[model samples]
Target: MTKNSAWTILAVIGAIVIAWFLVNVLFSLVAFVVKLILVAIVAVIVYVVMRVFVGGRDDRR
Candidate 1:
């Protein structure tokens, strides 16, 4: 293979690798955010349930 052709092939491979890495990183970030949101929602639900079942007593002295 010619030098120019070899360089072009290498460049294309590099671009593909970079693109793959970026896409993986983006997906990971999205997954993490989704997990965080789900946890927050669950926490809120638990808090509400506890408040409902455990009524606060008003003892003003």
Candidate 2:
């Protein structure tokens, strides 16, 4: 009986640790995705600004 209880406790602890790591990993993934989206948004804004300055000029001679 004692051995069985000890095994159960160990299993529960292991499961909790695994769950904690999984949650952390999911959060990190979400953070990374958010950063990627932010970078894309900034890039698009920069491109538009550059186009207005560089590409919208009339060069008719």
Candidate 3:
């Protein structure tokens, strides 16, 4: 093959590799955000449950 053709192929491969890396990074960020949201939701639910179960305080002795 010619030098120009070889260069073109190399460029294409480089672009593919870069795109793959970017996609992986983006997915990881999204997963982290999702996990945070889930944790927040669970915390709120637990807080509400706790309040319902232990909401009365007797301070008259």
lDDT of each: 0.94, 0.98, 0.95
**Model 2, stretches more than 4 Å misplaced?**
none
Which pairs in model 1 have colliding backbones?
none
Q: List the lowest-lDDT window of 10 residues for candidate 2.
A: 52-61
Off by over 4 Å in 1: 56-61
The TM-scores, one per candidate, come to: 0.83, 0.83, 0.86
Model 2 agreement with the true structure over 7-58: per-residue lDDT tens digits: 9999999999999999999999999999999999999999999999998896
Task: Count steric clashes of candidate 1.
Answer: 0
**After TM-score superposition, what is the CA distance of residue 9 in candidate 2 from its true location, in Å?**
0.9
Candidate 2 TM-score, C-alpha based: 0.83
The residue pairs in collision within model 3 are: none
What 10-residue stretch in candidate 3 is worst by lDDT?
52-61
